[model samples]
Target: MMENIIRLNFTKGKKTILQGQLNWSNRSADSIVGISGISGSGKTSLLRVLAGLEPEVKHHFRFNNICYSDYQAADKNIGVVFQHAHLFPHINVIENLKLALKAAHHKAKRGQANQVTSHKFELEQVIDGLAISDLLDKSVEQLSGGQKQRVAIARALLCQPCLLFLDEALSAIDKENRLEILTWLKTVNREHQLPMFFISHDSFDLQALADEIISVNDGKLISIQPIELSALSMGGGLNRAILNVQFDHHIQEHHINAYRLIEADSLKPNNGVLIYAKGVKAQSAITRILVACDQVAISTEANFNSSMINHIECKIVSILPLDETNQSVEMSIKGSASQMLYAQLSNYSIQRLDLAIGSRVWALFKLSASIAI
Candidate 1:
C-alpha cells in the first residue's frame, strides 16, 4: 500500500479536508509539482498543513522515511507565496524584504545552516528577476495587486528555501509578468535544484511549469500523473496532439539554445528536427509531447527559410469538418511508427497547398509551441 516513493497519510482537518494517502513515487528532486483543484477544495489548506502552519493536523502524518514534526516543518526554512500578498502594512517594500533576509540570516545563525540545501539566492538577483526594483521604495499599502505579488515572490526567493510553495500566488498577476516569473522560477529550480509545489487553478500554468500534476476533489487527492494535456480537463481548450516524442538535449546553435527532436528510440538515427523552447534541458528524459494542433501548418516540402522549426514527414490520413460552414477542417497525419497527429487548417489553405488524403507532407509548428509538457 505504501508503494509510492513518498507515501502520505495526512489528516489535515478533524472532519478531514484531506484524509487520504498520496501515492507519488515517480517524483524527482528537481521536478515542479502542481496542485490543482477548485476554489473551496482545500488547496491552500493542504499547503498550509505541509508548511507547518497546521501542525496539529500533521501530528498524525508520516511521510515515507521522513516524518516532519511541527518544529521541523515550521523551521525547515520553507518559503511560501500566498494567494493574497501578505505584506506588512506598516513597512515599505524594501523593509519587508530586509525583514525576510534578516529572518533567514537568524535562522542560519541558529546552528541550522545545513538545512539550506538549495542554492543561495542573492537579494539583488531575485529583485531584478521579478522586476520589482522600482517598487522597493514604496510602502506595501501603496502598491497595486500585481506589484505586491511581484514583491512577495521576490521575498520568497530571497529566502533561499530548500522547498518552495506557491498557493495561487501568481493568480493576481497579469499574463506577461506571470510568464516572466514562471520562466525565472524554472531556471532557478534547475540551476539550484529547488523543488517547488505550485498551486494554481489555471491549467496553462500547470502545463507550462509542472512536470507532474496532482489532482484534488472534495479535498481528497484524486490522482497524481505526468503532464498530459487531455488529463488537464481542458475542455474547449486549444486543439493539440499527444505524440510519442524523442529529443536530444538542449545545445547552442548560432547563439541560440534549442533541442533536437530525434526519432523514437526504436528508430535508426537521422538528422532530427530542431526546436527552441525555454523549458528544454538535457537532463530531462521526456519521451512524449503535447503539440498544439492549431499551431501546426502543413506543407508539401520542408521550408527552413521560415522561422518554423518542426518539419516532420507524415502521410495524411483523414480530414474532418470543424464547423457548420466548413471554413476549416481538422486533418490527421501519421508519422513514423504510425503515430497520429492533428492539424487544423482552413479550406482555402488546404486547396492552396493541394493536400490530399494519402499525399505526404511536412507538419510545421513554431519554436515557441514545442513545449515538452
Candidate 2:
C-alpha cells in the first residue's frame, strides 16, 4: 500500500483556484485515480503542479511516507503524458524512445556496459508491448495521430517512473487501439504497483478505469468515491429507450436508444437534428461516442455492402491540411440539418476523388468505431 499527501495552492491574475489541502491514499486499492471536470476547472493545473512544471505558492508532498518539497518531489521518478504527443519532428520513432534512456544514463554516476545493455533490452520489451516494432524507422512526421500517441505512451513507460500522470493521453487514439493500450497499462500497474493519476472528462472512462474517482470543480476537491457498477435507467416521453447495463472489472456494456446530432458548422447555429436513430448498441460504451475525424471515411458514393453502419449525406464545407507533410487533410462537411462532421483523408485520396469545397460526399463509420464517453 502506498500513501500520498498533497497540499498546494496556485493563483493567477486575481483569482485563486486551489486554496487548501488535497490528500490521496491507495492503502488497499488500485493505484490509478481518476480526476474529472470541465475545461478550465483546474484538472490540468493540478497535474502541472504535481509534475513540478508550475511553481507553487506553497506546497508539500509525501510519497511512501517520505517528505519532500515541491521541487524535490519532481525529481522522484515521475512520468507524464501530455495531451499532445510532442514528439521530436526531426527524429525517428526508435530514436525518440531511446532519447530519455540515454539522458538518464549520462546523468548517472556509474554507467556500465551491462547496465546499458539491460536498458536496451527493456526498451525492446516496451516497444513490443506497444506493437510498434515496425514503426521504429518511421519518422515522427510520418506517423498518424493514433501512432504518435502510442509512441508517446511507450516513451513514458520507458522512463520507469514510480508515479505517472496522464492528461487525456488516450484522447487521440481510436477505440480499438485505445483499449489495447489500456489493457497493457493495467497489467503494468498491477505487476509493478505503479501509481497513476488519470485526468479525463469522460464519465464512463472514470467509472471503468478508476478504482477511486476524485471529482474537481472550480479547483476545489468536490468528492472522492469508490466505483460501483449499477444499472441506470433513463426514461423519456417521446422516444422509447432500453439500457442494458453490464459491469465487470474489464468491460462495460451499454445499449441506448438515442438520437445523435452531428454538428455541421462551428460558426453558425444548428436548428435541426441531422440523424436520429431508434436504437443503438455500442460494443463498448465506457468512453464518449466520439469518432475521430481520422477514423471516418468519406466517399462520393455510398456502398451498400460496407460494414459501416452510419452514413450521412453531407456537403464538403472546407478542406484543411493537417500537417506539413501533406499526408492528411481534415475535410469538414455539413449535413442537411446544418450539422457538421469531419473526416481525415490523404491528399492523394482528396485529389483522386476530386473532393473540394461544396462537393457532395457521404461520411461513413461503424458503430464499433465510435468512442463512448
Candidate 3:
C-alpha cells in the first residue's frame, strides 16, 4: 500500500540574502527527496521549518496526515541528521543510539516504564545494522570523522521516523568517505524502505543519493528532475557535475581516439573503468561509444590480438537489471583499488554467461562502440 508522504509548504521571513516566495510539496513517501540551492539560499531555514525545530512562522506542513504546526496535534514523527556528528563527547555510541530510541518512544506516546527491555534490543539491532558493532563501546572522541557520522546516522535511523531529513549531512566528510557513507545510506534506505529528505548544494550528494532533485535558488524552488544515484558514482563528478557514462554498441573501432578517455580519477588505480570525455562536442569521435547496451558483447577473457583496444580484464561485482531489456553492470578492473566501473549491458548477456556473484570477465570495448544513454 502507498504510504502518506509529508507535504511541506512554508516560507521564512525575507532575508536580504535570499528573498523569494517559497512554497513546495513532496508527494513521495518512500523515496529520497532532495532540496538543492546555493549558499544562503534558505535551504537550511526551510529544513528547520519542516522539521518543526523552529516555531511555525506563518506556514503549513503535514506529515502522515497530521498538521505539524497546528496548535492541536502539533507533534509529528521526524528524524534529522545534520552535517556535524553532533554526538555528546561524553556519551558512547550505544548510549547515543539509545537516546534516539528513547526520543522515538516518547514521541510514540509509549509509557517510559514499559518497553524498556524491548527498546534495548531494538537499539542493539540498529547499531548492528549500521555496521557499528565495533564502535558500540567507544566514546565519541575515539571515533574517526566517518565513524562518528555513521553513528549519528545510526542514531537517526533508530528513531524509526517515517521521514528522515539530512542537512548537507556529508559536507564535512572527505570524498572517499562520503562515497562510502552514501552507498551505506542507499543500502539502509533500501533495506528499511525509509524515506529521506536531503538538503545540499553539492551536486555529487544529490547525484549519489537523491532519486529526485529539487533545485532551489534565492529561497525559491526552480525545478525538479529524476536522478539515479548510481549514475552519479559511475564516472560522474565527485564534487562537480555528476556525469553518467555511455558506450555506443553500433560503432566498432580497433584503435582508440584522443577523446576516448576514461575518468581521470577512475584511471588512478582500481577505482574507475567507465570512459567519459568532459566538455566536448556532441560529434566527437568518442561519441561512438554511446551505444545501447544490447549491442555490446561480453567475454570471459580478452580476445588476443583482437582489434578492440578497449578490452580490459574486469571482475563482475554486481548486475542491476534496468527493466526487462537492459542491465547496469558493476565491474572492478585489475589496477583500481577503491573504485568500481559500471557498464550497461543486456539481460540476454547476463543469462548467456549464467553470471553469478564474483564472476571474472573481460569487458570488450570496441573503441568505437558506445552506449546511447
lDDT of each: 0.67, 0.60, 0.57
Model 1 misplaced regions, further than 4 Å: 1-15, 59-73, 111-114, 228-236, 239-258, 262-271, 276-291, 297-309, 314-361, 367-373
Any runs in candidate 2 off by more than 4 Å, and if so which?
A: 1-3, 66-74, 106-121, 229-373
Over the stretch 260-293, how does candidate 3's per-residue lDDT look in tens digits? 2233245322133444322223332212123223
**lDDT per residue, candidate 1, 268-369, as tens digits?**
423344445544353344333557667787888867666675666677777766664333233334434434557877777778888778878888875442
Residues 127-243, candidate 2: write the lDDT tens digits.
887899999999998998888888888887776666678889888888677766775665566566676788876554554456566667787766555432110110111111111
What is candidate 2's local distance difference test score? 0.60
Clash totals in order: 1, 11, 28
Instruction: Note each model's CA RMSD in angstroms.
Output: 5.9, 15.6, 15.1
Models 1 onward score TM values of 0.73, 0.57, 0.55
Model 1: how far residue 18 lies from native, Å: 2.1
Ten residues in sequence with the least summed lDDT for candidate 1: 61-70
Better of 2 and 3 by lDDT: 2
TM-score of 1: 0.73
